[model samples]
Target: MLNTALFMQQIREHPIVATISIAAGTILASEVIWKAVKFFHSQLSGKRPLRVHEVLSFNELGDICAAQHLRKSMPGSPELTKSPEPIVLQCRNMYCSLRNVGKIVEQIDRAVYSLDVAIYTFSSLILADAFKRALQRGVSVRIISDREMVFSSGSQINVLACLGVPVRMPITSKMMHNKYCVIDGVERVEEIRRLKQRKWIRPYCSVVVSGSVNWTRQGFGGNWENCILSEDKELARMFQADFTRMWKAFEKSENNLKQE
Candidate 1:
């Protein structure tokens, strides 16, 4: 005999299970209704619904009627709006990827000082390629990563090393659960984790920033990923400081390896 109340309580505690159950029930109901509708519609004109064109605002019309809008748009090159300062923030809901991150990185042809990264998981093809390009264009790149999270063991490490991107693994108690990448002297944004309430759920809601809409999904175990970007010099300087410390720690660990 099964205890119905106890089973219900267990389901309530597990949101993923509950969501799956609801989705299954809804899908089942929809299938049944569709079959019934088909059976009735077989006797009538079978066709899909027609599309509709709704009226849009001037800005919306600007998007649609491209040539006229561009013609009507102001002539002397619109004034550059003052970019608001970056803020300190945290998230577990942002999803972006290494490839997505490169859209901003590739544009940096000349870097005077340095670029530092403290990433956990990265074996991204695009990431390696972008770094190669940046290095060729003369940017001092250093990365601190987890030893265990190396994306691949063979060619990637060798190629990236040849490209002059130094990588290190941190052995601190905290599993280096950081996803933010500091770029230039400005932005520092983080990637939010992506997950389904259940395996059957479809992804529709994507978290994007007003200034950073350039993130794309690619590389590292097939799921999307993200990084926090910021423009606040103070934040960039702070992360840079943290990277320098971690780099030294990683260097010590590496020397111990060489001595061994």
Candidate 2:
């Protein structure tokens, strides 16, 4: 009886502590209830979705986290790696990943002969400067960006065009949304300087970098983004073909406008 009375007295004296304890208890209870509801809802819906514990599955839109649940699971298949060889992956906003913008600049700075870039939007001066340096180094740099977004504040589209870098933009009500770059013609090597140092090492292949990441301040630092760099000739060729088609389409449109 005395201990009970003492406990009541303490609770009364420390109202804040009692309130905090009550709040914590309420939160815990709510969490349990929420989980129970989710379980019941899933059962009723008769939908079995893959959880996080399962292997990763990425959609076409670059969103990897879907139907995620907390559980301990093994990693995915070995073939799901970036590529069999000469492929690298750069990710941001999860785990330990490289800075997207820095990696992009590095990719450009290390270019030996050509750079084919097709993006939805671009407004980063750092990447612009890298393009300028590449141009100075006799590297062929071509850019394809969204026509609507090229006039936005801080856009480097005009700057590159003025500097004699071939810039292309499509005219359309829909967006030409693609984020990818093809470096050189065949293999994608992250360490181009080291490759060049070896006299026997030739630019055998091109690198294809494609992902949800965009070359912008918000895309790199503020938002969750991801990029994959691969040295597969087939993938590089696919992207390069698309870029060529888009470039030619825009060029044809410009010529039609001039004729009119």
Candidate 3:
């Protein structure tokens, strides 16, 4: 190893080299000190930087958890994973649903290409107006409703049919209790699976799902229900596939009935 004094002597012999050497030494010392201090601080200070694990409104966490559960026990196609964080926000309360509907309508209004809705009931006047506006904007709107319970959705369906919204009745002897709405042609799909059909009124105590939401006016003022809204594209894509399958199947059944 070169002696420090000898090294200094050699640098001094070349003043330009001396200056560069000193500057480099100073920068090196600063970096070493900075790193040392950082290490010491990390060891001494209990204040570690806030680690961002994931952001999940209670509803979003529910989506992530539900996806994981479905990935485990359910006999469905596996979902794509783009992010571990699968949620953005949760809309709760009777007013929350109403409040959220406005946002949903806003999103629907901005829809450019296509709008598709598969609803158990489609009687919300506010939602119907949004659909009409979308239709006016030249959006291709295709709605599939339960053939059995068109009572609640009767007015909305007639309005849509009058307004030229293509509505199809899913051919099923069972009630189409699945309230799944896909805007922009299933850009996002929410899977609402039945947990239990409860007798007592409970705000989503029985069933849960990851989706846009059910159209039931049950929230803070009404009964209770729970569902998660996800912006996760990967998960939505999978559900969209399922929707396409069911849509085609129902359409075929309807077509066969027509032929009969």
Candidate 4:
């Protein structure tokens, strides 16, 4: 036994679902009618309708066009107008490889203008190659690596510097343990401080990738780690400022090691 009344009530309550269902039904009915018309025409004309499968009925075509126009003309949701929140990504040892984060590397490679990287340990040659490609494409890449890890067995910071990327290391007894990167921060216009600021003004827009994951093979595969990708302009501006400050502070600590 089916509860027909209950189902009808539920459909009425969900207007969006009801609308979608109606649209789908209409399209299905229109398609059936179109096929029938084509079949009838073929019988009368004593020939097959040329490209019959490719042709859309006038009503169906008009509906599709109207829907597209509506989609284009509609205003974006308020949430969409703001910068997106951070998205979390987790990886575990002996499980799925965070190497899929290579997508993030690809993004950094395609950076139009600038890249700011701050990592405590960096040994991944895959990322090193991406940085080199970015440099070749005229993208300015600045790297901040831990002073100690730069001399580690597998550190590739020196190799990156040899490829014309600027590399900086903080001169501190305490490790600069941050692992993050900022991509393509485009500066915005200066704000007028005199007026009562009603609207939010982003001084720069950027993409920030940060978290526990270090740029190492073990970090991406053997070790448990988490990372996030954020497109918030305000957040990116802060990261850019922090990286700039550290880069300036480590003025004399630039890695000048020869590429091996």
Every candidate's lDDT = 0.45, 0.65, 0.52, 0.65
Give the lDDT of residue 59 in candidate 1: 17
Tens-place lDDT per residue, model 3, 1-260, is: 56988887787789898888889999999999999999889845534442211211223222323334345434443332433421211223323434445455555666555566677666677778888888787666766667754545344755676666656676657776666555443332122112234344211101112333445444211444444444344444565665677777677544332232
* Lowest lDDT 10-residue stretch of candidate 2: 50-59
Tens-place lDDT digits, model 2, residues 191-258: 34355675454443466778886777667545666777665556777887888778778884433321
lDDT of 3 at 143: 64
| lDDT: the better of candidates 1 and 2 | 2
Error of 1 at 51 (Å): 40
Better of 3 and 4 by lDDT: 4
Residues 41-151, model 1: lDDT tens digits? 863432333121111111111223334324433465332222231110111112222222333343332333345656555555555666676677555566665555544
Writing each residue's lDDT as its tens digit, candidate 4 over 135-159 gives 8876677888887787788888877
Off by over 4 Å in 4: 1-95, 187-205, 255-260
Task: Output the better candidate (2/3) by TM-score.
Answer: 2
How does each model score on TM-score? 0.42, 0.54, 0.49, 0.55
Candidate 2 vs candidate 3, lDDT winner? 2
